[model samples]
Target: MELYFLGTNAGVPSLQRNVTSIALRLLEERRSLWLFDCGEGTQHQILKSPLKLSKLEKVFITHMHGDHVFGLPGLLSSRGAQGVTAPLAIYGPPGIKSFIETSLTISQSRVPYTMDIIEHTGGVIFEDKYFRVEAAGLDHRADSYGYRVVEKDLPGSLDPKRLEAYGLKPGPQYGKLKRGESVELGDGSWIHPADVLLAPKKGRVVTILGDTRPCPGVEVLAKDADVLVHEATFMEDLAELAHEYYHSTAKQAAEAAVRGGVKSLFLTHFSSRYKDVEHLQPLLQEAKEVFEHTRLAEDFGLYPVQRST
Candidate 1:
């Protein structure tokens, strides 16, 4: 899977950064794309990327902030115009439904596809054969949330040569063995899959949090994640200011990632005041002091999420 950052700035847009929006490209995993937050100009950001609007299947909003959801109406309407007939699902806090409905109504936009709005209450929001999504309430100015995406373990590779050695040709029996089921041969001998198949590959976990201060349950949600995407709206010196504004500093985000035992930490949601690239050096340095694997995210940057060895 791959994460594409549409906008990485906090509160407002700047020359180098926009607001807050991220697109998780799951085309190889699920043949669809999932969006997190839809900050203003997010659709315009997507237009500059390789992502297709028709491939969008679901959107998860963190809060009702204007920077987090102002681009929803335009993206939804554009999806309809692109002839995406599949149903679209959106998960967010309570006010999300009203915001979307009112915006669509006021604009008189006609979407040809059915939209499913789920107001989650800090629990497992979605699950399927391939992946599962869990949500938790964050400590933000509004009812913000954090999402954890867990991919299910994939089956081990099957050896055709080994199967052929047992007088078994490639057929349904191979399928059964690949699924961890024992198969009976004509000689009344049972062949176990574990003896020949490779070990099952464990899935990866990704945790992304919305605008929030240092909050509880972040460690639980981000524990052992392959990557933790946290917001660092300020530097270490302005930590008190960040807390007062219900945001987090780079040091605090790094501390959470270290406590959560995540493999890598990606910091986003930068304040507009740090417009110069050099101005963000302090934030990166402070975060790296705590967690060496931490990196700052840039607008329109693509980050690949891979399973740990």
Candidate 2:
């Protein structure tokens, strides 16, 4: 899996960065794309990337802020023009449904595909054979949320050479053995899978938070995450201002990532005050002071979500 940052600025669009929008590319995992937020001008941002609007299977809104959701109507309408007939599901806090419906209604826009708007209140919002998504309320000014995307563990790889050494040739039985199934031989002896199979490979966990300050929910939602994507709306020096605005500072975001034991920390949602890379370097340095693996996100940058071996 990979994370594509379409926009990373906070509140408003800057010349260098746009508002909040992140795409989790699951082409290899599930053949779909999951959007984290649909900030203003998000559709335009997507157009500049390799992501396909037709592959957008789901959208998870963190809050009802205009900067985070103003692009929903345009995106949905454009998806219709792209001839996306597959069903789409959107999950978010309350009022998200009303916002989408009202926007589409006012514009008289019609999407060709069916859409399901789910108002979630925490816990598991979606689960399938390959993955599960859990949501938790965050400490933001509004009813913002954080999402935990957990990929399910997969069966261990089967050693075909080992099977051959055991007088068993590779065939349909090998497939069954890889699935942890027992097979009976002509001699009526059962071949157990545990004798040849390795331990199951653990899946990767990623946590992405909305606009939030320092809170207990942050730690709980991002525990042991492979990658923790948190908002750093201010520098370490302006921590008080960050708290006043119900946002997190770069230092605070690093602290949370360290506390959660995440392997990597991605600091995003930067304030427009930092106009250029030179201005944003201090924020990245501040976060790296606390967490060595911390990195600052830029618009259109793609990050790989590495799995823990």
Candidate 3:
């Protein structure tokens, strides 16, 4: 799994930062991509990356804020111009349908692929055989939400040596054994799959919080997550302003990550007040006081998992 930051600014776009969009690339046996929060100038961010518009299988909007969703219409229209024929599904807070409809209607944009709009009330919004998505209503100026994206538990690894020890040669019958069924060999001995398979590997969880203040939604949604993408809209010195604006500070974001039991914390949605993001490190270090593995995000940077060395 890979997380590519399209934009890392909050409230407004900066010369160095676009609004807010992150691409979750599942580049493995099953190739798919998921996006969180398409902020302003997000389309321009996509242009700079090696991402395909057609591969955008799902988009989860954190809120209806202008900076969070103003780029949707343009991206949707460009999806067709770029020849994306795959169906797209969008999940967001109330009024998302109207927002998309009005944008398309006013601009007279036509997309060849189907667009599924689901205005959620905060719960398990989507699920499939391979993945599950849940949402939580967040404390924001408007109706906002956060999403937890979890991939399905992987199948158990098959032990070929055990099969060979059982005098079973590789063939179509081995396929049956892999499915946890008894396969009859020429000697009439039954082979059990469980005897030669390892336990299933746990799936990774990635939680992305929309613009909001410190709340329980993030703790609940991001419980034991492998990666958490939370918004840190301000520095610790601006705590009062962050709360007043329904945004979070670097300190608060880290605390939430600790409470959520997240393995790694990625802080984004930085305020444009400071030209250098490095200035926020001292504030983020405050969060490390609560959670050790915290990182301040940068635009166009990719954060991939670093497994055991």
Identify the leading candidate in terms of TM-score: 2
* Cα lDDT, model 2, residue 77: 95
Q: Runs in model 1 with CA error above 4 Å?
A: 159-172, 180-188
Better of 2 and 3 by lDDT: 2
lDDT: worst 10-residue window of model 3: 300-309
Which candidate ranks first by lDDT, i.e. highest?
A: 2
- The residue-level lDDT of candidate 3 at 57 comes to 86
Tens digit per residue, CA lDDT, model 1, 1-309: 999999999999888898999999998998999999999999999999999988998999999999999999999999898888999999999999999999999999989999999998789999999999999989998999999999999887887777677888888988898888999988899999986687688999999999998878687789999999999999988988998999999999999999999999999999998995688889999999999999889887899998776
For candidate 2, the per-residue lDDT at 96 reads 95
lDDT of 3 by residue, 209-258 (tens): 89889888878888988888888888788899999999998889888888
Model 3 residue 282 lDDT? 74
Question: What tens digits encode model 2's per-residue C-alpha lDDT throughout 200-236?
Answer: 8899999999999899889989999999999999998
For model 2, what is the C-alpha lDDT against the true structure? Answer: 0.93
Candidates 1 and 2, the one with greater lDDT: 2
TM-score of 2: 0.97
| lDDT leaderboard ranking | 2, 1, 3
**Cα-based TM-score, every candidate:** 0.95, 0.97, 0.95
Model 1: how far residue 181 lies from native, Å: 4.6
Q: Each prediction's Cα lDDT score?
A: 0.92, 0.93, 0.85
